[model samples]
Target chain A: MKKKENKIITDDIMIEVEKISMRFNLGIEKGFSLKQGFINLFNIKKRKELKAKRKKNVFWALKNVSFKVNRGEVVGFIGANGAGKSTLLKVVAGVMKPTEGNVDVYGNICPMIELGAGFDPQLTARENIYLNGAVMGYSKNLIDLKFEEIVEFSELREFLDVPVQNFSSGMVARLAFSIATIVDPEILIVDEILSVGDIAFQAKSEKKMMNMIGGGTTVLYVSHSLAAIKKICTKVIWLEKGKIKMVGGTEVCDKYLKYMEGK
Target chain B: MINNLKYVYAKYSFLLKQLVERDFKVKYKRSILGIFWSLLYPVLMMAVMAIVFSNVFKFSTPGVSYLTYLLIGLTYFSYFSEASNLAMSSVVANFSLINKVYMPKYIFPLSKCIFVGINFLLTLIPLYIIIIATGTGLNWAHLFLPYSFICLFLFTVGMGFILSTIAVFIRDMFYIYGIIITIWTYLTPIMYDIKIISNSTLQFLMKLNPLYQIINFARSIILYHNVPTLGQWAGCGVSGLVIFIIGIIVFKKNQDKFIYYV
Candidate 1:
């Protein structure tokens, strides 16, 4: 039992991303298959020079980005659309590999990047809960233990037997949120998850998130809600067009808010 | 990269079980008879094909009845077709999960193989019933059945891994593969005997087909009631292993880039 826990290292740092970068060729014709590539071998020199220009073909989602997240730190990400917030979260969650550099995570991460990601729409809510639990790598026994509590939290007690495809978007989000947050993860990466559901559910979810954050769980949150960021996050990192613009306390959010205003 | 097999196996088995079970349920969801459809499907096909072909095409199966011979070949061929075809689309079908989650990716393809395999195994109940009904008594050589199926299962899984990986990049594989499977079914000795080809060159090429070897190996036991020759056993064993190795190598090499392609 003593040897079961993760060995705590000398430092409390939970995540260290060293200059990670992701490059994608965006246009339809930008990337070539084996057949087209074989034909291009003879037309090499001219194509090589054209490739260097790139010109709307190659886009860097994240360029030489580096960040460190310590254990028990509640960090929030504030960024505009296309600021690479999702891409950065994806890289940290190990959902996607970077084209260059690496990410080292020292804890078991539960990434709620998109709620209800792997749910089979035809299955009942109860079935989807188990399916989603498996996606998060929870054992059947663990899910069996948490089953009742998850249902009670989602307030879908009456509709547990219904298929998820017939459920409203709010009901789906509520269910997804409850299952994803049931386990006490070392690192919780939340990407615009709190934006869904009603204001009442929003208050409940925020309380739940606060409870987890209060329990010394390291959180990496991405939300358009700056007030929520200022209220809950210990630190805020502001990104602008795939580059980290600022990293500090709530003052950074103030600066970002000011920047977002046309000042 | 897969050094910790025990841990990986323990963690993934539940996930795999859930995936396979879900697919199994979804399989018979729209049908009225549900899982009974599994039993009826192969039996009907075998009856129809055996009745038609037993008269028009007679070549080998020296010691056994035609129904027994047909059932053995049909079972292996059905397993091969279902397993490989399902496995091929496994990765492409789960694009939502693939892009959003961080799993080994092989899990999707492997789960598809196991899902189809469960159906394949269930069909065996009917297969043996047909054999017993045809007056072909079970013999000591029946023990070889499990091993032969395992070899075919491995071969299908390996091919699934390779084909799913390729299918992700080449969106046209669904159309292209339809034609290939049709041609492949004709090449294998499923409905007819391999001996009827007549031309030595064409006969030799037909023997080179992996399905021909696997179907023959299975028939040697269920149809002939004898132990397959060492050469036949080796051929089945080596082709499964060889194709499986190639599939794994190709799948692993391209697995990392699957995120981008899918």
Candidate 2:
């Protein structure tokens, strides 16, 4: 259960997250160099002190989180700040490994976890489109065929040869969103990415996402906008302090909203 | 495990090629010379080494051209050090992509080695040019030069994996590796002839370096126009295969933990 197993399945289940728990070191010095690592290795007293300090500093971001998503299910993750929504999504997307348990995802995933995650600012928008496509696991021939469509969707045809660093934030977002959604992924993992770009482009991207979802793509979406959740999610999982507080229909979103408002 | 290997191959091999290409484009983006700099770099370094050692230090090999000797050693050593150094920071440099995407982590370092290897192959143009200019006439033994290149490439990839993995945990690795490579370059007999060393034990120890084995094999084929001895052949191939195997094992063991650190 310690490994994330990405398998292909013939049945309906697309993702299975089993008791996945992730822990982070909350100490101020979260990272140590090899020099410090070596010093700690030789110093027994310091090692003992560090071990004791580690227990107090350990913070679990996700704990005993287990769930399953059927093919084409639009599942929304709702949580307050620091309630492990992003961490859970990362574990499901295979970006981060869980500390205790494992996750099994049964299909190709397009993780919109971070818009323009692999975009290099130094490269021109034309080059970045191909690079971003590669990062999302698309072959060159496929990207070549879809290149014109991506540029048209991004509406950056005039700025294709211009370096992405010179582009406005909206232009970058438009390019990222276009490349990410170009292919019809089997599982789409979105983490607050719908809020990208201007209002008009946001509407366009959401419409594109709805088209994918309508075509039987399983989606794991994390967002704070309850209205968006209620509109898009068929099921909602409300997380609280590293654990699931509720899992059900959109009514759970209503209940979570009440809980937040009451607090 | 076999199925997993196939899955990764089917999925990520194209991504690897793209990453290598990206490194190439970004590295040479603003430069006027573009990738021709790869060829000119070693040529310039060889000129400096020949002037300093042949004229000032009075170092020379009796039968072989000193410039050719220095170029071969300089070319290969730079390749190894440059590839590994770039690879050491490869994981940390790509942290933005690593944190958000699910691609295999080893691709970053492997891509760096490949990108540098392409540059290394370009440097060979100068290497062969100098060889012919020095009257070290081409011979049948030169066909075996690819053997040395293959061995050196494997060795560099192995070292890249290990260094990139270590870099994930130790941010200081970049600085620490700088000092180590400086010490290594001086020890590898790149400028001075190995025959000048007075102590047999010290010379034997120098021979223990895997880099020396690969470079020495290439020198034998190019400069001396002879096939490598059985010992040299074994030394080059065995060290590369052994180190590459160890590197793979080390990388695979630590890769899962990399997401936490990088």
Candidate 3:
């Protein structure tokens, strides 16, 4: 209901990230344990530094980044490693709350951040489908309705009864992709899941994504694959070191490609 | 609050069911007698403890057979220990899934408690069997046993919420709680009588333990064949509710930060 209230005011905006900033504590290794904490307690200089305003261990992963995506717009995030693309995606998907500012998303998000994240390896593939479906917020009856479609799409009919622990990585990826895309999500956040499985399965998954996109599912995509970005994205945001460096169409991606090539 | 509960139940009940089923299945996957272990574990533990306490330690039971008293207390206490221990790590165990998706983080602990609670309910069958075997025949008062079980269930869930939240930040709690539960078990008078404690202050402090009150409620109904006094019911209810509310408050306040730490 909290997510629905704002949709009434800005119906067209599928996602509105307002000056969102996310900070991660790099001090996890410093005093995380009780032993380390006790040791640090007596170290006066270290304690004073911890109390100081400019703490060295705080790393801002995203800084005052603002953007809005209208309904059906496929917005791509292009960035080098550690450039805050995944953190921003997580914030928009409502997985991680921003340290400052707000992210207002109008619809349910299917985040393909790491596929098969919910799969219990000890369980059979058949069981994992329902378990993963429920984790994805699907009801039992809904999953039952689409169970066959998922099995057929994954091409794992012969291996459904086998535990996921025995599954080849490609088969697991196929099943994860099929279950994730079974229902057309209201908003889809894809973080580097396009490279799933073998080449044939990759093409199949891309076609499935295109079908979802054609049905007006707003997408936030992040990938290092520039060609894939140019193929699917209507607009692109280039990130550099936790800040947005550029925002535009495929032309920005071309510029990014040239920039990377020069480097 | 009622409306909020209803909303959560409607939205996430299916997920909770799936999680419980997953836990149940994964726990019993390779075992021959899957759920029978729930029934057998308590009975087996009671057999071991009943001999040691009654023979070696010579603990006396005034009204009921020592077997019945020990089994009742052991059954209820096992649920608390098992449920709380599992619930403590529920959040940390599911970190991989939580890192990817947006979920009400409280569900992980809640699901763990419910799963262990189901196993606890199964253990009651053996408790009743032992009671009947010991000639403490079933009585109408035994119908009121659920009152304490529900209270204990709520108390355990609240403890679980608080523990699970702490576990997200401080990984040491898992090991620390093991020792705490062992010390708490001895302090609860599960295997021995409270009469052995000669000091009135010590006895009063022991009575203040919530597990003692809940277990006493069960003992009154099952062993004594009498309804617990109104004061006893009030005490048990307040302890359960107070702890449950505190757990929820702590869990809610800290849940948003779990993603960062987890």
Candidate 4:
């Protein structure tokens, strides 16, 4: 394991999350009193409570997580299905707040988490491009300038005026990817949005990511594809059950691969 | 505060424009009268109430025709009531945007309030014509209508900010709001005259309802041709500002958690 001192910030750190944790209360029920239940036996005073008691449950999605990413670094966050990777990414992107601790981020963040989430189904593809562009923090003028390029990238030029809900899932993914990468984001947080496209589109997305990294955009990538992570990420963070199992070079990922392979 | 305002405007200007246009377009899209329905609905309601209440209830109002008086009060009250009601659900309604973006949460309610304000102003054109057709001359105090509207706008936005924020955590707020608005409209003296309620105790209680002061002030200027009393105007100004300030504070503090709950 790397010592704590090794985690000290250097000159290029762009994102830092200090002791962050998120807790969600589930299964908490409200409405109906014991007295009301007893009185309802006679049906004299009817129960006004309409809602039934919901099951109670709680989840600690992320726990005491801490990490720092330097500028221009492409760090892959690899974990199992429930490993808190997306939660951590969302906190850094400012979409969700940490229940405890602090997250400090520098520069503009373009989060490609759940791409096409902001697109209105009733809106035309052209309108959705503008809407999604604005939601992703692009000014109208910038969206206008990139409009042609985005359409060309998505290969949906003929259907620009058609509503996005009419488009197939792969078409939506292509458009979402094109719109998300239209702006040259300083810090890009992509959460499995790129894995939906065809092989050709995947290659195109990989090329785009490489170009962005080459141009000094720091990326926090969360993906289950270990092969993709091995190819793109300069550093890797292996997470298990919301805890960091290891954080180091690509060698640490090899160890993780063996651990997963039951070798 | 100024910098925060600038930041908010710079960030949300696009969304504001989009939502406002969406509201204006979607509201009248399929209606036969289109935007004319803005004027028609209030006038029709006023006519019905004027006939039913003025004769059946025999309430005496001073200085203005009953139809004109009811139109003025109903027009202004409906603005606040409709804006606040829609604003109560603004945050929850845009769960997709709220979950994805991190802008000022207050913009959601404020945008709805502004959209309704534009509609309210449009509806006033017919009211002006109706007042003129009824042979009532205008007074200089009527110029103060714009200022009164500003006060009402601030108050509605404040209430919206608070209600929308609370509604996120409490799901039954929609039903609660329905009941509150139904009761509140009758209590605010919209269809009735404030002077007819002779009970001193009930009058005092009615005075405590902040909306009563707003509607009365509007009525005083537009229909009664008199400036609002100093105490009444001051109360409106002070309470509106206080609610707006506290509302922004609460919204800013709780905005981060809105994504989860919404």
Model 3 alpha-carbon drift over 4 Å, by segment: A5-11, A32-54, B1-3
> What does the i-RMS of model 2 come to?
1.5
Best by lDDT: 3
TM-scores across all candidates? 0.92, 0.94, 0.96, 0.89
All candidates in order of TM-score, best leading:
3, 2, 1, 4
lDDT, residue A227, candidate 2: 96
| Worst ten in a row by lDDT for model 3 chain B | B141-150
Over A1-263, each residue of candidate 2 has an lDDT whose tens digit, in order, gives: 22334444567788888898998877636445567789989999998887778679978999999999999899999999999999898888888889988788877788888878788888999989888898988888889999999999888899999999999999998999999888888899999887778888888888988898789889999999999999989999999999999999999988998899999
Ranking of all predicted structures according to DockQ, beginning with the best and ending with the worst? 3, 2, 1, 4
DockQ of 2: 0.70
lDDT score, candidate 4 = 0.81
> For model 3, what is the error of residue A205's alpha carbon versus the real structure, in angstroms, after optimal superposition?
1.2
* Tens-digit lDDT track of model 4 for A64-101: 88998889889999877888898788778877888898
Off by over 4 Å in 1: A1-8, A28-56, B1-3, B55-63
Candidate 2 per-residue lDDT over residues B88-190, each given as its tens digit:
8988899888888888888998899999999999998998898898898799988888888899989999999999888888777888999999999999988
Model 4, stretches more than 4 Å misplaced?
A: A1-10, A29-56, A197-202
- TM-score of model 3 (CA atoms): 0.96
lDDT (0-100) at residue A12 of candidate 4?
68
Candidate 2 vs candidate 4, DockQ winner: 2
